[model samples]
Target: MKREHIETMISQEVERIISGTDLELVDVEYVREKNWYLRVFIDKEGGVDLEDCQAVSEKLSKVLDEKDPIQENYLLEVSSPGLDRILKKDKDFVRYAGRTVDIHFFQPYNGKKDLVADLVGKGEDGKLTVRVDGNEEILDMKTISQVRLHIDF
Candidate 1:
């Protein structure tokens, strides 16, 4: 099967297993280094524990075994998204509004490649308004190369 098809299958199976666990699926990637590695990141209101990871792992393993989507030898890793979780979808922007975020643009925006700002809100046109250094800037979602929650230490 194609890699994307396999990934979609794995994502669906993982979502089903963790539906009632209060955990949100952050992202899933199938990496092939020495062998296939399927990494699943999940998060919750507070956080996720090792036990949660283990439970999801076991359940997903059973599903994968039954489905056999991956023909090659592989290892499955289920874990928390951690402090710097990447924001991918529009829902992520809405869900994480009012939080500090670090965004990297494909091309420099206002002569900068990276920005650390407070997410204000999403505009009617679907642009993101963020306050960076006290200046509010409207960023086009299409230009965002990567966006992650910022952790203050």
Candidate 2:
């Protein structure tokens, strides 16, 4: 009924439809511009192609149509998270260990607004140790307001 609940439902349905496939749902959003848009971002080990998007879109459309969770007119879109995917959960940090990431803390740490570094490891306490500019810093997980993979240009 609520936006988050709807998103979670859609995410679960998408995950189920793509279970055997390489794709995984990254995020889901229900937004309004002219009409409501239910956007679903998906990713894979390599990447997602248009064909993959089409397949997921078709299947999800059927389920949504049957469930009728959204009362208003909406467009469903399935696509990739692109080069820099945000890391929202602890699993993301563990899965992307050793990759370069940019994390923003809720409060400044050592007078820094952002930290760009290699994800060294996660401590037993759930804090993250990142190597930034050859120095290691322990970032408390509770303080991590946002995190994303750093795409090299």
Candidate 3:
């Protein structure tokens, strides 16, 4: 099977396994470094603890072993997406509203390719409205290439 397909399958299985639990499936990746790694990113309201990771790892491991989804040697790891997680889904956009975000645009907007501001949430048209310099800047979603939580020290 294709790598992406494998990842999707693994993600579906993990989602099912963690359903009703506090854990939420963030992202999944099956990549090769020195060895193939099947990394699953998970999260929760307060944050995921080691026990949560262990529970997910153990259950997902059992399912993967039984299903034999990937026909190769790989290491399965379950963990959090970390502090600066990228806002990939609609839920993320909603969840992180009112927080600072760094938006990378495909083309320069008002002579700038990137903007850092407070997320004002998504509009009905899917445009992202952010608070920039005390003003609301509505951005077309298509023009945006990436959006991540901006971490400041």
Off by over 4 Å in 1: 33-35
Per-residue lDDT tens digits for candidate 1, residues 1-153, read 888888787888888888876887888989999988999998888899999899988989888888777888888999988789988767788999999999899999879999999998777796889998898889898898888999999
lDDT of 2 by residue, 1-153 (tens): 788898999989998999988788888989889989999998888889999999999999999889898888888989988789888766777889999998888899889878889998787797888998898888888888888899988
- Evaluated against the true structure, the overall lDDT of model 3 is 0.93
Q: 1-153, model 3: which lDDT tens digit per residue?
A: 899999899989998999998889999989999999999999999999999999999999899889897888999999999898878788999999999999999999999999999999987798999999999988999999999899999
Determine which window of 10 residues in candidate 3 has minimal summed lDDT. 63-72
Relative to the true structure, candidate 1 has a C-alpha RMSD (angstroms) of 1.9
Error of 3 at 152 (Å): 1.0
Q: Report model 2's TM-score to 2 decimal places.
A: 0.86
RMSD of 2: 2.0
lDDT scores in order: 0.87, 0.88, 0.93
Error of 1 at 101 (Å): 0.7
Error (Å) of candidate 3 at residue 149 is 1.3
Q: Which stretches of candidate 2 lie over 4 Å from their true place?
A: 32-35
